[model samples]
Target: MVLLKNYISLRDQAEIVRICHILGVGPGGLQRPGYSTGHKLQLHRTCFGRNWNQETKCQERYNRDGSIPPLVPPELVSLIVTSVQDARSHVNSHDELPLMSPDTALVNFYTATGRLGLHQDRDESPYSIRRGLPVVSFSIGDTSEFLFGHSRDEDKLKNVLLESGDILIFGGRSRLIFHGVRTIFPNSAPPSLLQKLKLKPGRLNLTFRQF
Candidate 1:
């Protein structure tokens, strides 16, 4: 696992917010995700490059609404790649994660009440899974209480505060660890960001990975 604090500049973060707003207005954009049991998630989601079917653990070009999802922006792709490479330098050579050609981005916008139950990101191909390709995640806006552990036992889970402009990457031996968002801290976003983007009270998370 690797954590880079304030890695994204304010200017770049603003640009990303703009892009998200633009894409979120179209079909197959920012909508509540639900489980197979019909329980709606507290957060809204939109996909780029490829849409993910959570229940099936499959990737599709079209979304549930039968509309094509937007392509992942070039800037985002560049950011993801660069972040991973930089993270690689901070770890020991033996634990360095494999560089992946990420072609899918899952964007989630979470409110103060948002939370995600513990889960493992294992939907990628067997080869990708075997290589321990990293998931490059960017956090913007409000802070989140992130939980991670080898097992589902809440007592054993560790917590981390993911703030705006933070980047979290986990792969290699830690790729299959269970993780999730416990909650979002209210009024924790940078004031300038909220004013500039006219954003609501929430955090925007983008996870880049190869499928």
Candidate 2:
């Protein structure tokens, strides 16, 4: 539940968009599970050292199976991991943050009408779960109404507005909390950002996790 507002600058945001374009971030780029046909959001995924299978919903160290692409650039991974660790250290000196080296990323695109249902990120390996690694999430483009609840009760959900350039880090006691994107605000993106990235009205989210 730790939020860093405007954590990334406009220049950095545009750079990330460029990188995503180079890496590919559409239907043909990363294939989601066939069962996700009914889902509203579109997703593009990339792995660092490990790859996740949406169909089987499992993660494994990458191999030459040709099913998944290679890991994201090391520089990008370092930027995210370093930022989260530094932020956590500033909050509590003895917070016992896990030594996190993110190996997977889920890039999700949401239109004004797109929404993500409440869910927990519990697919990491047992070792990762035991260590309680944090999930680092970044937002670009439109703003979103993010819902998070301690349990599965929708009535107890707390709402938060996630704007472009915002970063969210949840772990430790807050890890595994039920969370989802309730809705997206149309035309909420920075005009310069949309033009620079040549994007339509939508939000792009990048979540980093360890496996």
Candidate-wise lDDT, in order: 0.88, 0.74
Point to the candidate with the largest lDDT: 1
Poorest lDDT segment (10 consecutive residues) of candidate 2: 25-34
Looking at candidate 2, what is the lDDT of residue 122? 86
lDDT of model number 2: 0.74
Model 2 steric clash pairs: 47-71
The reply for model 1, stretches above 4 Å from the true place, is: none
lDDT (Cα, 0-100) at 187 in candidate 1? 99
Error of 2 at 186 (Å): 0.7
Q: Once superposed on the true structure, which residue ranges of model 2 sit more than 4 Å away at CA?
A: 25-33, 36-54, 59-65
**List of clashing residue pairs for candidate 1:** none
